[model samples]
Target: MDTLQILSEQGVLGSTPTVRLQGEALDLSSYARTEDAEHLRSLYSDMFLVRRFDQESTALQRQGQLALWVPLTGQEGAQIGSGRALERQDYAFPTYREHGVAFTRGVEPAELLRLFRGVTNGGWDPRKSNFHLYTLVLAAQCLHAVGYAMGLQRDQLADPSLPPAASIAYFGDGASSEGDVHESMVFAASFKAPVVFFCQNNQWAISVPATVQTSVPLAQRAEGYGFPGIRVDGNDVIAVEAVTRWALEHARSGKGPVLIEAYTYRMSAHTTADDPTKYRLSRDELEWKARDPLLRLETYLRSAGLADDAFFEGLDTRARAAATELRESVRSMQSADLEDRFAAVYAEPHPLVQEELAFFREYEAGFIDDGQHS
Candidate 1:
């Protein structure tokens, strides 16, 4: 099968929606095949809380608390879904804006906020949660993922008694245009590395729509590079989790890499700095809002009789509390000192860095506060 590649009458891949590209009707409940309603309800609660965390972080940025904020308001489904699918052994390499996944992986929201607040490059230890530091260089982390998977292959070869592990690289539709992502795919497939290339096709790369990126579906691009690929309704958390779980298992079980193109929409601006209204159509916005992931999940929960008014109200209450806690945590993050700017660069200080540090210290000493003596 050609797998669900849609093209415009004018020769575009997204001219019309395919069965695999349907908005919110993917029926993940069918695929999961479990009746643990409470667990699913908990998933809904976590998703809601993460969305609130995302909003609060954005507000923090606007309030001069954070230097920059990469909003993931519309990407909660893909992030939380895939995040929920991973095993503790699996490692995640994420680009910036993966706040939901970080939350799912047990990263403290305040710690992640530090990166945006300019207090530190990253506040948490990636090894602690198998969640790698956020890579800000577009698609650079794709290469890191492939390299880590290669190491996994090597370690397994070196120790025949070891179990398998998978590594996942999270990137946006825009990062797909980077050479590093493609190169990472090439290497992952050639070596049969245990890696899952999770591409969130949120329809726009900054201001550029996927239409300008490629002619075929993003997921199917894996086939050409020697791996199986699947497209899922990214807004449907069930579908994303199920598909991602299967892909990760396949890779860990020696089936090599899998490319998952999550057909989602970026409902908000690309970042707090960019204006989506300048690049996107109002109709597109309306369409995506109708297909909102959180709302769709809410619908399914209600229709499935797993949720009610009180449940939603309670969730809202919990979300508010969580957001308040996160805000407070951000407020408590310690400001970095001038010396810290030079630390962590090397195990031991280098000559030039030492010189720069000395110069900076002298510069600071020159600016004495009115009556203070140093």
Candidate 2:
């Protein structure tokens, strides 16, 4: 299906939309709420800041300050748009690379590094932001999100006055192949859970291409589960937000879950430990770069005269400052006590935990005479 995109290649909204859903000319154009120049500007600012944050975090990993880093260099639009689309009561289950979503959920940039720095058990408190800690276990969060959505149903039934809420599961094309996604969809469809399955099809899952995951578009899978599905131009931030807002509304309004495939690209390595140059062609990267999410938004904003040079300049300065502050924060961070780390491994203390803590203590004791590992 043609991806739903409000903006054309040059960042101008198309006069006619050719996108389709269920074999119908999909005109979700009215879903876009970016007509207000200020809202569009805010979206641009979020993407710009997220891009800078991603760059700075990658640099930290390269410099040995972080144990590892997941790059989100090319997914600013998909993340920020959908993230901003979430209501305050909604919850998000994210993968490790969702720094852009974390930013939208009010997660401090430096706090995200605490885990990679090995300084804390987790980066941030999920309850504070309603954005869960990054899940590294593939599509496991998809199931968690569905369960949480079901709980939302129970909560509403109990209180009847509580604010309506939904859940969103952010996974990738690679994780879409996991059985967890299938099970989650089954349960969500069966229970009419309020959740949105958001797949950021960056095309590669580590070294594997998305083609290996599915022959058809990932969004189309929602049909078998008995819900609506749509493929949106993940590079178009406005379009993403619009689609996500509609999905969230559908989910919480007693309808079944929706599946959203954000068709975008990953401009960097899968992680600091990955080397995309080994698998992808440079020319392909160049072509996608032209469809850069930030560039299109900037183009639209400028052409419409929504923002001036001073506004962009201010954003640039803020981006640099944010990066600088994050670097300082990471450099100053200290690891938590080894005991604390072991304690957080499980909800309850176990013999294995004790054995591991004991081993660590013995190892540290061996280094008592010398400031080096035994």
Candidate 3:
């Protein structure tokens, strides 16, 4: 199918609309009571800051400050909208490129850089933020999310005082093919785990196009597991948020898991190491650019008079300041001691770990005082 036809079929482009609250030709009442001005402004601010964070990290990688960086430029709406839908008790298991979701979860941008900088395995405590560490291995976190959801179910049954909670597993179209995701869905279905399988179908999984991922829509896979699946216009933040909210609520209420296929496009390279020019067409990129998430929301804000020059100008200033702070923080980060790597290899000292540490020490001792090989 053509790009326009595919997107239109998925409710991402052209005439058939998905749920939306703020848009040029859309009625707000159809979604919910019109979102208050403050709420709308907050959503815009979150998207802007996350985009700035992404840009700063990409620059850092280019400057050799970070080992690698994953850019989430075009997927901001899908991440932010679904992230904001989570309740405080809910948990999220994210793939490496969920900077926007991490932003919504109250994680510091600098902390997220620590892993990419090779300073730590995980930059933050999952318990503290209810956001799991970035999972580098594809689809691994989906299993973890399902297990955690089962635990939440047990806890809720054991203690009535505890609020209902659900878990969200964030993966991409590429990771969906992994056996781990399939196993996770099977276990979740059999156990009726309260987990949401949130797939960001960004069109391209690394260099491979979505056409190669599956012949049918990714959402339809949920039906085989005995659950409902939804396809949302991922670029439409309002629609994403609404759909995610409903999905989360359904799971939290003990209706079992839901799979959300967020039909979106990856406007940037998959990661800093990738070059989209090698595989994707320039025309396709330009077409998706017109459907930019931030631009559409900005249009709604301006049309509704909810935001003005002062608001935009102030937002720009804040985004720039945040980016500067992030860059400086990453550059100023100190490397951990070599011994520190072995310290956490085992909870307690293990014979194998000790032997490896000794070998590492002996290897370091071989270096000459002049910093040349002896």
Most accurate candidate by TM-score:
2
> Which scores higher on lDDT, 1 or 3?
3
Structural similarity to truth (TM-score) of each candidate? 0.90, 0.94, 0.92
On residues 215-244, what C-alpha lDDT tens digit does candidate 1 reach at each position?
777876887898877777677676678778
**Tens digit of lDDT per residue, candidate 2, span 1-374?**
12256333232345443444544556666777756778889999999999998889989998999999999988999999999999999999998989999999999999999999988767799999999998989999999999999999999999999988999999999999999999999999999999999999998999999988998888889899899888778898888888898899999999989998888899999999999999999998998898899998898888888999999999999999888999999999988889888988899999989998999999789877666565
**Candidate achieving higher lDDT, 1 or 2:** 2
Off by over 4 Å in 1: 1-34, 371-374
Error of 1 at 257 (Å): 0.5
- Predicted candidate 3 versus true structure: per-residue lDDT over 255-345, tens digit per residue: 9999988898999999999999999999999989988889978988898889999999999999999888888899888888877888888
28: Cα error in model 3, Å: 12
Where does model 2 exceed 4 Å of error?
Answer: 1-19, 370-374
Between candidates 2 and 3, which one is better according to lDDT? 2
**Candidate 2 lDDT (Cα, whole model)?**
0.88
